[model samples]
Target: MSKKNNKIYLDFAATTPVDREVLKVMMPYFSEKFGNASSTHSFGQEAIAAVDKARETIAQCFNCDFSEIIFTGSATEANNLAILGIVKNVQKFHIISTKIEHESVLEPLKELEKSGHEITYLTVDKTGLIKIADLEKAIKDNTILISVIYANNEIGTIQPIKEIGKLLEKINKKRKEGGLSKIYLHTDAVQAINYLECRPDWLKIDLLTFSGHKIYGPKGIGGLYIRKNSPLSPIIFGGGQEFGLRSGTENVASIVGLAKAVESAFNNKVKNFKKVSDLRNQMLADIIKHSGESAKLNGSPKSCLPNILSIRFSGLSNETLIVALDRAGVAVSAGAACSSRALAVSHVLIAIGLTPKQVKESIRISLGKDITAREIKMATEIINKTIQNLL
Candidate 1:
């Protein structure tokens, strides 16, 4: 890989560089304001106050009460806590999720299934969207939870989250009318925060998960929003912290950084979307024009995230393309960074109806907030050249 400053990074889906402004706000928390949030002294009180303010800022973004936010070490941890924690309290029940969920969500569901919890993995259409009817059909008398990804990390297809949420809300209402239990909705909103509306109440979601690193903030910090009165058992046991849901010493710096990142993202969302999406479109057009009939878009052009472009070139190896792009100083990925190391084709591609050959030919190009038109043009030129050589 090229040196950090030299490479044109188009892999924002994997992670993002922390913004300088966010870093500035986090500096004090690391040293000068360094105090255990649980301490009773003045230093501790100051740290705790900062942590509280951060929580409140994040809550405001999600349109939820401050008490509902529980900070965790990462989005993966938050996901595990939400899935395992919820299923722990229910002895026997059915859970519904889609096949394209992040590994964090899928692995936990597998564990639940092993323990005899019935799980229904919904299928997605060609556009990488789940049908509401399929979801409705999956629910049963013992249904406890329905978890879905807000926006797919690999393909960047935004699901019909609001529709699913509303469906669940109506179902819960019917269950209430019949004096039965209500089903809860959970969304892993990690990839959606930068480009989608994520207010929990508006989406009618009982649980939501997001992380900092994807939004130009420090890593090792993320949070889960639990609706009031939602039943959950603690996944980690230790000194009571985060309402006893996540127990550990608060990561003061990253927490503060997350708040600043959220504030920046929400404030400039409209402007950033316009700029990044235009660049993505231009890049896609050039890439398609250069690659000709051999190239095809992988996800729905109309319904996908603004900054992501997943495409496949017929008979081309994505692994070779990724390595060539990397050597050419243009960074991209074959799939989710978490699973990129595996030799197997992406589960998401297979789930969306791609054959094994098409899966091997696919690559993901995710845009960052700071990417420029010049950079996109140059990257596309490099990609075109690489594809030509590979072909």
Candidate 2:
């Protein structure tokens, strides 16, 4: 057994600890190479070169043209820019999204709805998988966009983006007869990039958004990949930074860190995924073995990400489990940290058809590269004991 520590972090889905090497790369940008990338002097030239190198690395990770990547403040900003930027240019716009999308997607759609845009939230199955047929039927002439998450953050369900791409290709072909408006496909790929195989060119996504923090990079920096010549209006207007798409001075240090983190993560994606997934599987097996009939898996068993595991307890509440685990020196979450404070049931859980009781009883346990098999074993033991005592 490993030495017992009071803090076992398994909340990687919410965010990750920055890699030491990434931090090392970002250090000089903050103090030594500190120059506004927009400046014309030699100092600025170095900063600009660094940012350009980062941008190219990001593009290579997505296998897209370097010019297509636009750095933004965060994935939330990227999602907003992608959705609002596209919809603003069209009249009577319509969008198709899953009911279980991250609030970043749902809230923007809500704001758009309040602004008078029509939206149809496609329902998901019990496993949290959205139906492609539903998506197909929802595509109307006014459907300006379809924004689906590549993989869910809460439940770790991988959506059928490639299948949807094929469906859209067929629909786009037929819709050309009536001069139908071209439907743009966008995916919030923040959670899917490190954990899944995402080929934007093959998937035919018009826009893809990802954040650096989610993939073990610095927070507050992300990028959106817009297919060449995709019609998108600028949400923020200022000096022509990021092709005048995002107007700001740019967080040079964070951007540099994000780029390095994304590059390194993608480079080691396959090996990292296998390592994390093995730890997660061990934890899941232990949870079931210890908790027996009371413990159950919440997300898609087969088609989900290797890192995230949302477990449901039949009798105990999430709060109890989290508190008990924390006291025992294990850290987990009931859901997204953004919504962790609310005592209400998660919208993702509700969308997946879990009862109010089941939702309150559920807690999300996500793993990262830092998590070891020993840590997983300790966490599961704490969780089991917590549930037993709560009952």
Relative to the true structure, how large is the alpha-carbon lDDT of every model?
0.91, 0.87
Q: Please report the candidate that would top lDDT against the real structure.
A: 1
Residue range 23-71, candidate 2, lDDT tens digits: 9999999889999999999999999899899889888888989889999
Candidate 2 clashes between residue pairs 3 or more apart in a chain or in different chains: none
RMSD of each: 1.4, 1.7
The true-versus-predicted C-alpha distance at residue 114 of model 1, in Å, is 0.6
- RMSD (Cα, Å) of model 1: 1.4
Q: What is the lDDT of candidate 1?
A: 0.91
Clash counts per candidate, in order, are 0, 0
